[model samples]
Target: MSFDKIRDPRKIRHQIGDMECDYIYTAGVAGERFYIALRDEEKLLATRCEKCNITFMPPRLYCDNCFTELASFMEVPSKGVIESYTITYFDRDGQALPEPEILAFVKIDKTDGGLIHRIGEIKPESLKIGSKVTAVFEAKKERKGALTDIKYFKPA
Candidate 1:
């Protein structure tokens, strides 16, 4: 659904830690391969469909477009603008997340790909259709092959 208006982070901060990170843990397709670019190396990559000239961000092992097993990778930018977005307040368990967490279809720059990650350091209302943002990653030495590897994106 949709919120009537964006909820204020300040008010929600009272319930959640204002400076805390929302630790996320989830299973993904070909997560092992992606972790290389995400944690061990701070890189943005997509799986390139050699046959169709299409790339899948959050890289895929197989292309649904042509249903071929993709084998090569294309390194791209972690930067992009919001193609579309929604402010969500739910955790993976369907419990409300600390209100105002942004769920966005971030269109990664320089390629036809994107990553859906949390948007931090901005008010929900201030976000727009094309707001520019950059990826903020956790220190590689501490990364453990998880979504928490890249903390979130914020005002670039």
Candidate 2:
């Protein structure tokens, strides 16, 4: 290509197009059941692998350990231990938040999978790695089929 062709402003133009796709998302087998339990029953359900004797939170249809099809649904205690945590002071858009929010990875007892949620009603300095906590669900009538069903995890 010649330099004249490369430098021509008329040859260059910005093209814009909208990128969009729409679809209804159905939570797979395990998630659907778990969400229903949270919304209607106010219960935390876990799937246990009878063969390997492993329990999974958020109820998996298959076992990660033995790869067995998990069908045993059990209610696990809402109590958990904080595996890790962070205190965030800013919003996603880089604006300062009115107050810092404590986010944590809480590993519910006797289950493999854990929940990631906000920690409340406690000071940041008092938060510990193994702090005992429990899932706090929103009011029954206020619940929606989502992770926000449990508003936050607080000290047990």
Candidate 3:
């Protein structure tokens, strides 16, 4: 039966058993390059759109403004200022965490965009909107091509 003609609720068929499915996700061209730099070189990469004169963190393949292909990739300083932040006392499951975790949206120097990551090495009371922070990466031996590769951002 075609779903296009369906009008009655009783005509719908339902399955109760769980469906098994598996999938893998790739970061795509621009993201792959970004991750590689972050993992292998411990560098923060940003893509610039010459047309719009805008730089994007977590680099993009194209510019959102001019729709120009972003061919220029550059390393942005790992240090940045906290534009905004929050302290979460509960975990993802809503359970109370032993210690509150600080998360911030940091505007990296010389870039139009920034990264949102956990802020560490400082008390929540001390954090401010303009606080200077730096990315703390995982040890070289433990580096991985993922956002988690950055342990957290700390006061610089």
Candidate 4:
């Protein structure tokens, strides 16, 4: 316990190991409903806050503006406009990807919020700001209750 008796503190033994975990998550009130719509109906849903008069994509349980509980769910259009974009050439591990991936912030028509998803079916250099795009969903039977249910957004 006394540092005075220690000669080389840096030489002390240290343990190294790997840890892994698995679990299920409840997507909360709004998210569960939104995801279910995508999986079962091939539709996108948003939460409209009555008090704040705002609609949120990938719906949240509460309004960011007025802090009101958002309960009304509405089907949002699959079509939107590209607000911004990027072509990523590297993966998360910093390795180069076989092909660059186009990603963008799509502003759904008439909605206050937008979804950030992959852009497909067009060259990266051809992608334009304010360009129209539509979500292409996976076949109904193949969809899991997740964002990937929509394979990608393509030119409308």
Best by lDDT: 3
lDDT of each: 0.79, 0.89, 0.91, 0.89
Off by over 4 Å in 1: 1-29, 89-99
Q: Tell me the tens digit of each residue's lDDT in model 1 across 60-105.
A: 8898888998877778887899888888777778897656688788
Kindly give the stretch of ten consecutive residues in candidate 4 with the minimal lDDT sum: 9-18
User: Could you tell me which residue pairs clash in candidate 1?
Assistant: 89-97, 90-97
Instruction: Extract clashing residue pairs from model 2.
Output: none
Q: What are the per-residue Cα lDDT tens digits for candidate 4 across 1-156?
A: 567776876666756566878889888888899899999988888988877778888788888888887777889898899999999999999999999999999998768888999999999889899999999999988999998998899999
Tens digit of lDDT per residue, candidate 3, span 1-156? 568787765577765577899988999999999989999998999999877888898799999998888887899898899999999999999999999999999999999989999999999988899989999999988987999899999999
Runs of candidate 3 exceeding 4 Å displacement = 1-15
Using all chains and alpha carbons, the TM-scores for the candidates as numbered come to 0.69, 0.87, 0.86, 0.86
List the RMSD of every prediction in angstroms. Answer: 11.9, 3.8, 6.0, 4.5
Error of 4 at 55 (Å): 0.9
Write model 2 residue lDDT over 1-156, tens digit each, in one string.
455657656576756678899999998999999999899988899999877877888789998877888876889998799999999999999999999999999999988779889998899999999999988889999999788999999999
Candidate 3 residue pairs in backbone clash: none
Q: How many residue pairs clash in each candidate?
A: 2, 0, 0, 0
Query: Scored by Cα lDDT, where does model 2 land?
Result: 0.89
